[model samples]
Target: MPVTKATDADFRQLLDQHEKVVVKYYADWCGNCRLFSPKFKRLSEAEPEVAFLDVNAESSPEARKLANVTNLPYFAVFRNGELLETLAASKEEAVVELISKLHAN
Candidate 1:
């Protein structure tokens, strides 16, 4: 699935609507965030069953708070609208591992 751009307005609704979600929290000026955008998109496409979201950490306070975002390019996985894991990394492997948690039983 394609990554959806989310904001404070619709973040909660998206979380509630999707059973497995992965959110990438980024800031416009963060270099690593910009660099990892394409990778995040590719990951989303690879995992069509998961809901991928892109949220600007600087702008989406509510969503940021949910994951306790403290760094750029932060990735959070949610299952059934509940947070399961969070990772702050620029590496695709790390993000992949974070996403894997959503399906782990």
Candidate 2:
């Protein structure tokens, strides 16, 4: 699926509506986040069955607490509204593996 933007207001509710989701927390000024965006979008297109949600950390204050994101490009994989894992890095292989495992389950 195409990557969608979610804010603090509706991020959780959005995730609750999807069976499999990949939520990415990022900031505009972060180099790591900037570098990962294109790869993430490509992955979303490849894995159209999964919901990809992007959140701008600067604008979404509540996201920090909800996602517990300490790094520039934090990713959280969720299945049926429950968090499966948290990834602190911005790598394509790691994301692909997480989604594949979650979707398989």
Best by lDDT: 1
The C-alpha RMSD in Å for every predicted model, in order, reads 0.5, 1.3
Residue pairs clashing in model 1 are: none
Clashes of each: 0, 1
**Model 1 lowest lDDT segment of ten:** 94-103
Off by over 4 Å in 1: none
Query: Which lDDT tens digits does candidate 2 get at residues 1-105?
Result: 999999989988987899889988999999999899999999999987789999998899886567688887988888887888888887788878777867675
Candidate 2: clashing residue pairs, number: 1
Clashing pairs in 2: 1-48
lDDT of 2 at 42: 95
The whole-model lDDT of each prediction reads 0.95, 0.86
Model 2 bad stretches (over 4 Å):
none
lDDT of 1 by residue, 11-87 (tens): 99999999999999999899999999999999999999999999999988999999999888899999999999999
